[model samples]
Target: MAKRPEVVPDILDWYAESARDLPWRAADRTPWGVLVSEFMLQQTPVSRVLRPWSAWLERWPAPAALAAEPAGEAIRAWGRLGYPRRALRLHAAAVAITERHGGEVPDDHEALLALPGVGAYTAAAVASFAFGRRHVVLDTNVRRVLGRVIGATAYPPNHQTATERDLAEQLVPADPARAARWAAASMELGAIVCTARNPACGRCPVADRCAWLAAGRPDNAPPRRGQSYAGTDRQCRGALLAVLRDADEPVVGERLDLAWPAAVQRERALAGLLADGLVVRVGERYALP
Candidate 1:
């Protein structure tokens, strides 16, 4: 508390020795690759994104390449990564990068933020990871690690606060490259060791410095619950989208009905997809958009 937390160096050392060999982190990885990985990684696990990301970059290695294609192609290629909207947004972002930034993922945080579908968190992530500029890259994993280590909270607030932002900013190293490394290191620590449930405390590099561990690791203020999937509208949506994704061409509305059992739920999900621009009505058939 008096000085920088003693755990910082330990976490960095662990990261250097233990980081996953992700394609996005490869020395040869392009800025476009990093941007694409970031977009695919939101809410979805790394395991699911690996094949898709590889094939995608292989197909469209640069912003200009993806921007040249129809947005619907991006959706079809997305292939059940859960939120297909991200694919559309990434396509839009690619278009912006191609037209406005001349086919380059801009290094400036503000410029990245200006791209379609790029939010504050994404802007900071792209700037720090891709460009190696100092910024507080607070993703969900980073927030959980910080909450436990510094605030002794089992979980962070549902919404990030001004106080949380100030703490995160103070924790970032002043040197751009060092700050970027720390940002990544802390996030990795959260994802692999300080997990949401059944954290491997014995494996954590900063177990000794963690305020939550020292405080007996009390329960969350409310409670933590795993997300539900069965019978949800999200499940219905995925089912409907999967049918469209696999089709070689636009299929009749009747063909889509075969994908899901509940007619009313299927119709609602279909309407929602149309609204989100993830699906399109072509004459009497539905198709990916």
Candidate 2:
């Protein structure tokens, strides 16, 4: 068994003071709000999500309201958040909620996971934050923090195993309220202090207990590969979506043709978007459907 760090308490204590008071975390946040927040946070940064989340909650305060609207609105509402599929998936989730859960977010983890966009992280988050259940909320940030504080190296190649889950559960404070805060704190610590690149160890509350530091911070066996974004199909899709998101009406192929010049990449991008149901073609014009 790996030796656990002792400074988890200090980290959580520091997080209580430093964590951002996000709008989605307002005292009046309903289960619907929590669900929306988890969706918006996927692949999008906190600063980018703030204004949009506020606007979304203000416009559609419940799943029923969102379900009543066309899914295109959700995609347009997502703005430059990237990964527009999340918006479509969220719309489907709203519809499922209205049909299955009486327009209310499900409290049960299994029921939540059954939703279109909801997954393990989201289900556990909603369960803990909105429903006050004890569950290990593991995200990339949590995994990084746990890996450094205990293993003194990068995370393993695959997802967390049963043993890792048990260890995380053990570290969760027994008090439900505090445990929820602790989980969020661990995530925040990993995001801001114990980050993936050039971690701010000087500012970290758990530095003293970090096994990575104790082991002299040796470079791991190999460097992780970085993802390529430029000239990729994803970049072209985003460029195409940007135009659709801003257009008040459907745009013709000529207009979209102007966004990207490469014929092959442009056709591939358009086909991918069409296949993803992000855009619909009426005659020669394209628009969000």
Candidate 3:
């Protein structure tokens, strides 16, 4: 008989014994709760997502609650989460949910994908986690796990491509409940043990079957690109949004100038925010809409 699959069982068993008892994983977590958690988890750590997620679920509890409020509340609620744009997107998604799905997070993949901020990864995650659908839920952790388990690399060359998705789907266990748990478990292993740098292979459950170990743990891949944050428009945008989010009423252009030193970049950032619908201009003042 062919070699028994190692990663799935090892990961599931490890997760069964070791997975963190997160608030979102509670028995009473609603679909809205799952949606909010997924959005918060994007490019953010689980540690960071916890408190805010709990507070958000406690405050809103449903799409209608968030949808009824101004976008500024979401931005403020986001609070140092990094990538505040996701807050705006979540707010828009809430509005969309209210209008389209009668304030319920749709269970179907296509409908979920159509939400303002719900992309493929988030859509699949909600479907699997909330509804327990059998779908290949690929995230950064899952991608890295697959990379080491099969390709002997830290991560796939360029994220989840068609080939990568096919590989992930092939690895997903047949049962829906087990498959969801396996996806979360594989991600947990990659996050805590099979980390990008200085991986703790000894602690990894699937270390016995890891191709990267078989290949002598070589770093054959190029270093990932560094992001430029200083002097970028993103900083300017953040500063502008901070001012707007704190204000009770729309801010004048002159008021926004206090946030940034560069006038031109500040103007550009405010204009971009207006175009993005994150901010609305009333005569000369800007406020979250």
Q: Which candidate number would show the highest lDDT if scored against the true structure?
A: 1
lDDT of 3 by residue, 35-126 (tens): 99999999999999999998898899999999999888998899878888899999999999999999989998899999988999899899
Q: Give the alpha carbon lDDT tens digit for every residue of 1-96 in model 2.
A: 475746667977898788878776778889988888899999778888888888998999999999999999999998888789999999999999
| Greater-TM-score candidate between 1 and 2 | 1
What TM-score would candidate 3 get against the native? Answer: 0.94
lDDT (Cα atoms) of all candidates against the true structure: 0.89, 0.86, 0.85
**Sorted by lDDT, highest first, which candidate order results?**
1, 2, 3
Model 3 Cα shift for residue 110 (angstroms): 1.6
Give the TM-scores of the predictions, in the order they appear: 0.95, 0.92, 0.94
lDDT, candidate 1, residue 220? 80
Instruction: Report the Cα RMSD per candidate.
Output: 1.7, 2.0, 2.1
Q: Name the lDDT value of residue 91 in candidate 1.
A: 99
Candidate 3 clashes between residue pairs 3 or more apart in a chain or in different chains: 251-285
